[model samples]
Target: MEEQRALRPPWALVRGAGDGSGWPWRSTLLLTVFVQVGSHFAAHGQEGGRAGLDAFARVLLVLACGQLLWRLRRPVPVVFGTAGVTALYLGAGYPYGPVFLAVAVACFSAVVAGHRRAAWAAVGLLWAVHLLVAHWLYRWLPPSGDSAASWGQEAVIAAWVAAIVALAELARVRREQWERERAERAEAARRRADEERLRIARELHDVLAHSISVIHVQAGVGLALLDSDPEQARTALTTIKSASKEALGEVRQVLDTLRTPGDAPRAPAPGLDRLPELVEQAASAGLTVHLEGEAPRLPPGADLAAFRIVQEALTNVVRHSGSRHARVRLDPGDRTSLRLCIDDDGPATGADAGGGGNGLAGMRERAAALGGTIEAGPRPDGGFRVLAVLPLRGEEEVDR
Candidate 1:
C-alpha cells in the first residue's frame, strides 16, 4: 500500500478521489476525530446525562471513525468495517453518536470511484441493519411513548443517505465530462504535429533538388571544357563553387529550423529579390534566361512560394531543354492577383522532359496552399510552358 501511494501521481490526488491525499482525506479524518471526541464529552453530565461513556466505548468509537482514512482506495471494505463496528457499539447499549458518519462517507467514496451499483447495494444493507437495530431497541428498552420522535429520527437518517448519494453521482458525471475534453485536446495536438512534419519535408525536398541539379550540370560542363576551353571551364568551376556553398547554407538553415529548441536564429527564406542571382546561375549552366516585368508586392509566404516555383521551372529548363534561350514573364493580372509564365524550346533528343516526379507535385502543393492554380504542359509552339495565377488577396488576409 505504501509503494502504491508513492507511485500515484500528484495530479490524480487533486483531480480525482482515488489517490490517498489532498483535502478530501484530510478533512474527513479531522471531522471524524472532532465528532468522536465531542460526542464523548456530550455523553457526560455536560449534556444533562449523568451516565457517561466508559473507556471501552470511547475506544470503539475512535476505531470505527478511523477506518475511514482508507475510504478512497478501499471504499466498499471500509463501509463494511465501519458498519460492523457501529453495530457492536449500538448493541452494547452505548450512547447514540456520530460513529455511523464514517459509513456514509465510505458509501460516497465508492460512488465517486465509479462503483455506483455496488454503493447503492451497500447503502441498502446499512439501512436494513439500522431498521433491525431500532426494532431491537424498541423491544428491549422501556418506551417513553413518544412515537413522533422515533419516526422523525428515521426520516432524518433517510434524508442524509439520499443527499450523500445524490452528491456522489453528480461528481461522477462531472469527472467523466472532464476526461472527454482532455482526450479531444490531445488528438488536436497530434494532428498539428503531423502537418508540421509534412510541411518541413516539402521544404527540404525543393531546396535540395534545385541546388543539387545546378551543381551536377555545372560540374559536367567544367570537366568537358577543361582542355578545349580553359576560360569557360574556369567559369563553370566558379559557378559550381558558389552553388555548393549556397546549397550547404540553405540545407543547414532547414535543419536548424527543425532541430533547434526555441527562438533560434535562422536565415530568411528566399523570395523574388533573388531572381537575378537565379538567372545568373542558369546562364553559367548554358541556358540564357530573359527576365521580364518586376514582381508585385506579395505576402512573405506567397513570395517564398513564387520564388521556389520559378526556380524549379528554370532548373527543369537547364536540365532537359535543348533550347539556348528561355523566357520568364511576371505580370500583375489584376488588383488582387499575379501571373507567372515560363517557356522553353523542346528538349534535346533523349533528354528527359519533366513529366512526373515529386518536383511537380511539390510545385502544385505550394500553389494550392496559397489558393493559387498552376498549369504545365507542352505548348503549341513546340516548347514546354508553365503558367501560374496566384491570388494576392488571400495572402493579404492571412497577413492581417
Candidate 2:
C-alpha cells in the first residue's frame, strides 16, 4: 500500500500558481527590477569595476529588466538568452549583477513550469558561471580572515539566491504529492459508493421480485380454482394470505438493510430450501413443472441466485411466451459449477409490449452477480429455452 503525503498548505492548493497573470511573474518582475538596479550598485561597490556602468552595459540591463517580466511564460529561452548576453558583457569587461538576476529568475520559471530536472540543471549552470566569473574575471573569493568585504558580499548573494530556489523546489514537490493523494482518496470514495449501490440493487431484486411473483401467482391460483375446487380454492386463499405476509416481511427486511444494525432484526430470507413451495405455487398457477436431481443446499449467494433465476425465468414463461408446459433441470456440473436449464415448450408469440421486458434482463443480471451467465432464445424444437450455468466457490451442506 502507498502511504499518503501530508496535505500541503491552503495557499498551495489554490490553483493557478504560475499562470502569466499569477503572482509569480508579478513578484519576479519586482525582484528583477530590484536586482537590475542593484547590479549597478554592486559594480560600483566592487574594486575597480568602473565608477558606473559603460553605456552599452546600461542598455543590456535595460533590455534584461524588460524581458524579465515574461520569465514564467518563457523560462528556458529567457535564461539562455540572458546567459549569452551576460557572457558577452563579461567578455567586454562589464559587471555580473544583472546577469545573475536573470539566471535566478530563469531557474524559478523552470520550477514553476514543472520542469524539475531542467530547473536543477539551470541551477548548476548558474553556480558554475558565477564561480568562473569570480575566479577568472574578478579575481575574487569569499572574504577570508583577510579583509575583503566584496568577496563576502558575492558569497552572501550566491547563498541567498540558492536558498530561494531550494524553497521553490520544495513547494513544487509538496504540490505534486498533495494532488496525487487527493485523487486517490476521491477514487476510493467513488468505489465504495458503487458497491453500496450494487448491494441495494441486489436486495431490491431479491425482495421485490420474489414477493411480487409470489403474490401474482397466488392471486391467479385463487381466481382459477374458485369455480372448480372450493377446498383447493380455500387453500389458495390461505396461501395468498401467507404470501402477502411473507412479502410484507421481505419488504421490511429490505428497507431495514438500509438502516444501521442496532435498529432491528431482519426477517431471514428464503433460499433453495423453498424450491418446493415455488414449484407448488407454479402448479397452482396452471403450469406443469417437474423437479429432478438431489440438489445440495448451496452458499447463501449461490442459493439466492438459483432461486431468483428460476423465479424470473418462470415469470417470463407465464408473462411472455405462450408456454403451458415448462421443465426445470438443475444438476451439479462437476466440482465448481451448477447447471440450470429451464425449457418451455411454448411458441414465441411476440407478445407483451413487443419484446423489451424485465423477466429476461433480470435473470441475466442475477446470473452475472454470481459470475455466471444466461442465454435465452428459441430452442431447436420451436420452443423457448432459458439456459444458465452458475459457478460456486463451495459445496452446499445438505442434499435434498
* Root-mean-square deviation of Cα positions for candidate 2 versus the true structure, in angstroms: 9.0
Alpha carbon lDDT at 265, candidate 1: 41
User: lDDT at 209 for candidate 1?
Assistant: 70
Off by over 4 Å in 1: 1-35, 38-105, 131-155, 259-266, 317-327, 341-356, 371-389, 393-400
Clashes of 1: 0
Off by over 4 Å in 2: 1-178, 217-236, 261-269, 349-356, 394-400
Per-residue lDDT tens digits for candidate 2, residues 15-133, read: 22434254455555565568667876778776364334768877776566555555556766766666556555554556546566666656655676687676666566655665565
Residue 59 in candidate 1 has what lDDT?
Answer: 78
Candidate 1's residue-wise lDDT over 240-326, tens digit each? 889889888988887787787455547788898999998988787777999999998888888988998998888777667778788
User: Each model's number of backbone clashes?
Assistant: 0, 0
Give the Cα lDDT of each candidate.
Answer: 0.74, 0.65
